[model samples]
Target: MTSSFHFRPMVLMASSLALLAGCTSSPRTPAPVEDRTTMGRSSTPTATPAAEAPKPLPGSENAGKPGYYTVQRGDTLTRIGLDNGQGWRDLARWNNLTNPDLIEVGQVLRVSPPGGAVETSGVVVRPIASSGPSSSVTTQDNAGNKEPTKESASKPNANANAQAMQFIWPSQGKLISKFDANNKGIEIAGKKGDPVLAAESGKVAYVGESLRGYGKLILIKHNGYLTAYGHNDKFSVKEDQLVTKGQKIAEMGNTDADAYKLKFEIRDTAGKALNPVTLLPQR
Candidate 1:
């Protein structure tokens, strides 16, 4: 009985050790896989979008005739008129514009007179015809009474200065040069910085240095008539501004000239050059 009890205790202890070894030898299951692919909420920056360009205005070119002008980007009323050689005020008046600065891009505006007709407001009176006393004509009426007919009749020469715009001296200076075949205008000598006046009431058409040999110039328009003042040192009036006769518009200078002077000109409604002396009042 004692030998059997010892053998049974040894068997029980071996079975307990086998169970513990099996538990340690078996591989442990891998821990739950971590979600390493997930990232933070913040992100990288991207490029910004670019701005769009302005659209171009549309129109056609018809020189010296009634036509339309398209208002383009960076275009003002004065700039449009200057480019077309039309006065800003005249353009505004012709288009019935109540506000000159309210022009918009892509807007069409009138640039000529209605029906392309030349405006004439002045009357030309003809000189009386001289006749000898014996050249009188007699007309006999139905009642047998003789009556003398009228001799001198006044008529207008439409081709002559019938609607010419009158002008005055642009500056109180000595006439240094007169208009000639070689020159389209006259030059008046004056001191530097002398006041330059407008020859007639009109709208400021152009004000810039675009024209060669005319430094710092200002162009004015009177109806169909156009006047130019050149070699100015300073401009008092801007483009599109209304100026009256004798108004100080600029300062005389020697820009593009050998001496200080003012270059003045008078152009017809069609841009033909005219003698300034004929239009200007006698000094």
Candidate 2:
């Protein structure tokens, strides 16, 4: 017959889509996914099985809010995603990391606001035992406590790093530099993509690319504490991810490093950066 105008129907359809978006619960990260199967064809989703309840997503009722992630044995970044309502891709993106399949025990991860986050190398979960005043009193004491010596502080136990710190090394390497109050972090050198361990056990709060001197950075948060790793070849976990002690959270080797070194920083609940030499084990 004659050509007819039908602008109202298009407007109604667009309005309906906007309404639906406003009504449903959203996910931490949503992306455009292609639908390969058409009306005549069907295919199973590549996601984890539905029978096993997926892990809670960050901020969801199922996913525990930003907090500590206790790294258990046999934990992997992929498993953490499935457990925390995240996927491998999103996890890596959140943590500013490059890998997703590898993660280890006793590592801590922190999930932070958009734009910045921290990841601890070799994260630990348990709190450190405040062994009442040390028998050896020395120069300074926070509260009549004996001054911890560099000798003792150099080699904070690996078990202790897990039990107390909840994080571990970003990679197996020697400490090339110490955490200086003026400088603010320690330096480590290792191979490219070397497994960086987590230092504490916590949820991944944030992961980003804005690390200045640090090439590729990962940030994590623990109970009233935070850790950061920079100049990495890649990251291992995502925001709101739960990790354990000695977990592989990132790969070593500076993105801008001539020698492929790592920059490590730790902060307290008060956001005060602390000297890692006070608690790390001797190299």
Candidate 3:
């Protein structure tokens, strides 16, 4: 009876051990999977577009272009020709203008000589190549005959000796203004209808009120030099009229000036202005 009891207890313990092994071997629920791709969104940054700049106005370009010039307001044909290295007559001929005094703003003109076999003798009357102190007048009579005059006795000796054209005061007055970059000439205050003399002897190149800021203007060409007399009450001489030194060319007035005054200037062969005070004799 004691041996049977021990055997039975051993068999019961073996069965309990077998039951625990089987329970451990059975499958268990899997741990939840971790998501890595969508954790905190993308790390790269998004791009953005930039804005465009404004464009320039039409016809505003080509200011520095050669062989052509775009006319601005207040511009005259004479002024344009002087600015370029040509005579106003040549420009008129090149452009086939019936009236040299008429030109509109924004008109594109040919600054260079025209192509083809064209007569250029029209330019000989006022040649840019014949610039110097030598005075040679080719004045023609009504019969188309060349009239000769003696060398002007009024020409200053200093200027003649230096091979430069002599210049003189255009009117008797007090100098109210001076020359500058913007002010291309000087202003001399005088009485109304005061005599405005020719600074130098030459044929009148232009006479009109076509140019703005200048009233009843007169442009004279002396050898390679040129002079401008502005703000006149009345013009004593007409275009193409021959003028002598101290000769009355106009009557000074307050046409475009603040007072009764004459605006005078002296320009070189290239149409570059020289100080009138520097060229005019001592007052």
For each candidate in turn, the TM-score is 0.50, 0.44, 0.56
For each candidate, the alpha-carbon lDDT, in order, equals 0.76, 0.61, 0.74
Query: Model 3: how large is the Cα RMSD against the reference?
Result: 15.8
Compose the digit string of candidate 1's lDDT tens values, residues 1-283.
9899899989999999999999999998989986554555345655799889866532323322346777778887765665555666667888778998788766778766678776432223233343444445799999999998876543444654424455778998999899999888999999999999998777777787755677888988766577889999999999767787789999999888889999998876544678899888887
Name the runs in model 2 displaced over 4 angstroms. 1-163
User: Which candidate achieves the best lDDT against the true structure?
Assistant: 1
Task: For candidate 2, write residues 197-266 as lDDT tens digits.
Answer: 7776666665655434667767666654567778877778877688776788887765755688888877
Answer with 1 or 3, whichever has the higher TM-score. Answer: 3
Cα distance off (Å), candidate 3, residue 37: 62
Residue 74 of model 2, lDDT score: 72
Error of 2 at 240 (Å): 1.3
Clashes of each: 0, 87, 0
Tell me the lDDT of model 1 at 86: 64
